[model samples]
Target: MSKEESFQNSVIRPVIKMLHDLLAVHFKHYMATKKLEFSQLSEKEKTNFIESSFNKDMAFRSEIRGLVIGHFSTEEFLLYATMQRGINKRINTILKERISSNRQNFVE
Candidate 1:
């Protein structure tokens, strides 16, 4: 398949799905281990938690970027970066909403 086609069907779609699953799993584990809903976290704790999670996720994405650059052409690499940014933006929105809802759960 062409790079664009392969990227859409194989890379972007699967990666986005995987990222969502990863986020869900991580959040569940985090809450379980902390024994507190998001709202229960202090402001500093919340900052730390978000930073830690963001770093882990960014590291994962960096590894994927490295592998893609090694296997794909330069043009495809650019495309991949652009698509990744867009995908991540959407995921960020979902994460914010998830966190907000988690906080609300504790409020009620």
Candidate 2:
């Protein structure tokens, strides 16, 4: 597979999976802080909210990105730094999918 795909599978996916619970909690908190009634939204709307939140909220995006990136080793980080933009896009996409698929985890 490609270098990006390798790094994603080897590093990013595991880190995100390891932190899945934390991510869910953060998502719930994000909805609360934004005064969004996450439970009230339909499945489609919930998916759109997840997409729009990442697209529109830089602070929230960065915070989530930081959580995943912070777990990378120095070597993995160097690799990521070399292709920051592309890797970041991959990270966000994976994160969005993870969150969307695990939507049940966020329900109170």
Candidate 3:
């Protein structure tokens, strides 16, 4: 597969999976801070909220990015440094997909 795909599968996905509980906790805090009633939203609205949060909230996006990047090895980080933009997009996309798929986990 491609370099990006390889890095994503080996590094990004594992990081995301490993930090799943932390991500959920952060999402709950984000909802509380924003005064959003996450549990009240329908499935479709929940998905939309996840998409909109990443699109509109730079701080939340950055926090999520840091959580993933902080787990990378020295060599993996060096490779990521060479293609930050593309890797960032991949990271965000994967994060969005994971959060969207696991919306129930975010609710208390």
Computed on alpha carbons, the lDDT of every model, listed in order, comes to 0.53, 0.92, 0.91
Q: Roughly what TM-score does model 3 have, to 2 decimal places?
A: 0.95
Where does candidate 2 stray beyond 4 Å?
Answer: none
Where does candidate 3 stray beyond 4 Å? none
The positional error of residue 92 in candidate 3, measured at the CA in angstroms, is: 0.5
- State the lDDT of candidate 3 residue by residue for 1-108, as single tens digits: 989989999989999999999999998998999999988888889888999999999999999899999999999999999989999999999999888888888878
Task: Enumerate residue pairs that collide in model 3.
Answer: none
How many clashes does each candidate structure show, in the order listed? Answer: 0, 0, 0
- Please state the error at residue 64 of candidate 1 in Å: 12
> How many residue pairs in model 2 have overlapping backbones?
0
Q: Which is the better candidate, 1 or 3, if ranked by TM-score? A: 3
Model 3 lDDT on a 0 to 1 scale: 0.91
Which of the two, 1 or 2, has more TM-score? 2
The alpha-carbon lDDT assigned to residue 67 of candidate 2 equals 97
Residue 75 miss distance in model 2 (angstroms): 1.0
The candidate with the higher lDDT, 2 or 3, is 2
C-alpha TM-scores of all predictions: 0.32, 0.95, 0.95
